[model samples]
Target: MNHLKVLALSAGALTLVPGLALAHGSMRPSHGGVVQMSGEIMVELVTKPKALEIYVTEEDEPIPAADFDGTLIVTAPGGAKTRSALKAVSGNKFVSSGRPGSGSKVVVSLIEKKSSAKTFASFTMK
Candidate 1:
């Protein structure tokens, strides 16, 4: 019947919504780090020997590091948590001192200065 056809069409359209939502950009990490997609924004976390790096991008383009205020929360394997402020280092990079140990979990939260929008990315160190 026509009613059944309409319902089927509506269901099909709903399935495509998610795909369209993710069409804004690729989720791959461009900075040799782990990447997470927060809505249309992409956040990448790079762990170094003595520092942590955070990168933010939207629509596959880097968002200026100066536009955000960020914080890094690292939970060690033994359950100790350390919090550090992320400072803008360059174009789209934010850095914080102290490297997270293996088996540690890192969470970076960034707040946009102009809109106050928050983007979060989580990573588990190997």
Candidate 2:
């Protein structure tokens, strides 16, 4: 009985390997920022005292800035919400000159310049 149970568990574990191998982007920050994955794409957000920057990538490949435009909507600690537009600075990097204070929630939306495909990500300030 115990041997049969072990075999069943092993078969179940093996079945999960493919899904794990095809898992989404990395969580390790590449540019000293916070990262989240949307499908196969990775979104990284960096907060500064006077600005907020976002970076996007897929499978470790940088997504060109010229291909997308994005916006950030931040909910402040005191409950006020502010919207800021992001301008591409370089490949995979977009910047906006305002920050949502710590403990706030930031939502970023991007529209592909050519295809018009859209993607979104949300992060809580640290």
1-126: candidate 1 lDDT, tens digit per residue? 999999999999998776644378888889799888887778888878888888899988999999999999999999999988999999999998788899999898888999998888888988
- CA lDDT of each prediction against the hidden true structure: 0.88, 0.86
Model 1 lDDT at residue 111: 88
Best by the lDDT measure? 1
Candidate 2 residue runs with Cα over 4 Å from true position: 1-20, 23-25
Q: Write the per-residue lDDT of candidate 2 for residues 45-124, one digit (tens) a residue.
A: 98777888899999888899778888898888899988878989988899987877789989888888898888889999
lDDT of 2 at 15: 85
* Residue pairs clashing, model 2: none
